[model samples]
Target: MGMGTTTIESAEVKAAVASLREKAPFVYGLTNYVAANLSANVLLALGAGPAIGSAPGWTGAFPAGAGAVWINGAALMSSVTPEALDEAAATAHRAGTPWVLDPVAIGAGAAEYDAILGALLKHKPSIIRGNASEIAALAGGAGGSGVDSTLDSSEVIDIIKGLATRLDAVVAVSGEVDYLCDSAGRATAVRGGDARMPQVTGTGCSLGALSAAFCAVVDPFTAAAAAHAAFAAAGERAGRRASGTGSFAVAFVDELSDL
Candidate 1:
């Protein structure tokens, strides 16, 4: 079937946001060091509990018990080993815990890094989120420079649909307009985020973590779309009040809380 496109309504986004506040799901993130603080803060602001740990023992335990899990490929470059990430994915799978995979700088990395991310595909992530370049790379195209997307989200709609179907997961490509596709080839285009969002470090990475939080309450497709919708809405609000990227970061979290 051809991919169907739709926009996430404000009511749907609001319902998902309200559910997060009511449930306050515990989200375990094995994310990169640079994104850890912001990722956890984003979860907290959304009224979800955040736990970030990648110690040998914690990796297996946290994902198994938390409401949801987030695994960022950038974590491998930091303190988390490939084995730990694999174990986390395995554990989440075994426990039927929903998890989001952010393949940050996937194709741009060395062979070992790319191999680690490729191996993760076997575990079957609930959602896979990345920039246009990263998603394109995941679909066998060239990767972005570092974590930056070299292409626009619109440029990779078909790849996102293919990846979503092949992986049986919700795949989200973040750019000027975020695109999210599910296994059934249904896609959502969320537009509203500010340009300054990319200027703040970890904003995109934190979106993966936020998706995990939403997954704890909704289906993978809804969770992924809601995350983008929430980010877009909050980014729009924050951009209006902030002086620069630094203030935008703070205001973004504040807007999330207000949501």
Candidate 2:
């Protein structure tokens, strides 16, 4: 993502945030790792109750009242079996809850990515969130470097649009200029985030969770915008006050609380 090239639409963002407070749905986070826990924390900080239930056996008990569901592929390929995830996704779908998919590390391992992504799609995710590379790879674009999408926004626009159409889901590509689009061929770009953001580890995961929170109440467009707003605002706050990654993470959480 670029440092100072784009700007966030604040009015639209505030409206989205307001809608979230009213709905306040239980959010189910299916991502592995304590880093994923940071995302759960971000959701709580933003006023949504989070439920962690990635296991197939426990998935049946996944809060039926959940506003939205988030599945992060971060540690899933390593620990969680594909069959289990497929079942979990099916459970979420049967409940009629909008689910979000985070295709982490799509750029690196083909086998792992295919397995996890296949299970995720079985659930028919309502929204899909990822970095440029993850989104591009999912969209069948040029392969990426590890999990990081190296393609510039311009290069991946067509790829993202194509994938969004194929999946029939809202696709949010995070980078210097975040892009959100659906099958209708309509795409919006959200600008403005600190360059220091990539220095932090869990910020991307957190954004995925925030997107889930927004999806709990608003349309895909509004949810995508709210997530962009939360991240940009958090980045701005972190940039102005923090000295490094550690403090940036702390400050980002503080900013979310204020929001």
The best candidate in terms of lDDT: 1
Over 4 Å off, model 1: 1-9
For each candidate, give its TM-score against the true structure. Answer: 0.96, 0.90
Tens-digit lDDT track for model 1 on 185-210? Answer: 67778888898998888999999999
| C-alpha local distance difference test of each model | 0.89, 0.75
Cα RMSD (Å) between model 2 and the true structure?
A: 3.2
Candidate 2 lDDT over residue span 1-259, tens digit each = 2112223446767777777776677888777675666887788778888877666577656735577887777756447666656665677789888878888877576776666675577677878888877777776666677656777765677777777788888888888878887777667777767888877777787788888899888877668768887888778877799888888888888887787
Model 2 spans with C-alpha error above 4 angstroms? 1-9
The TM-score between candidate 2 and the true structure equals: 0.90
Report the CA-based lDDT of candidate 1 relative to the real structure: 0.89
TM-score attained by model 1: 0.96
What lDDT is reached at residue 3 by model 2?
A: 19
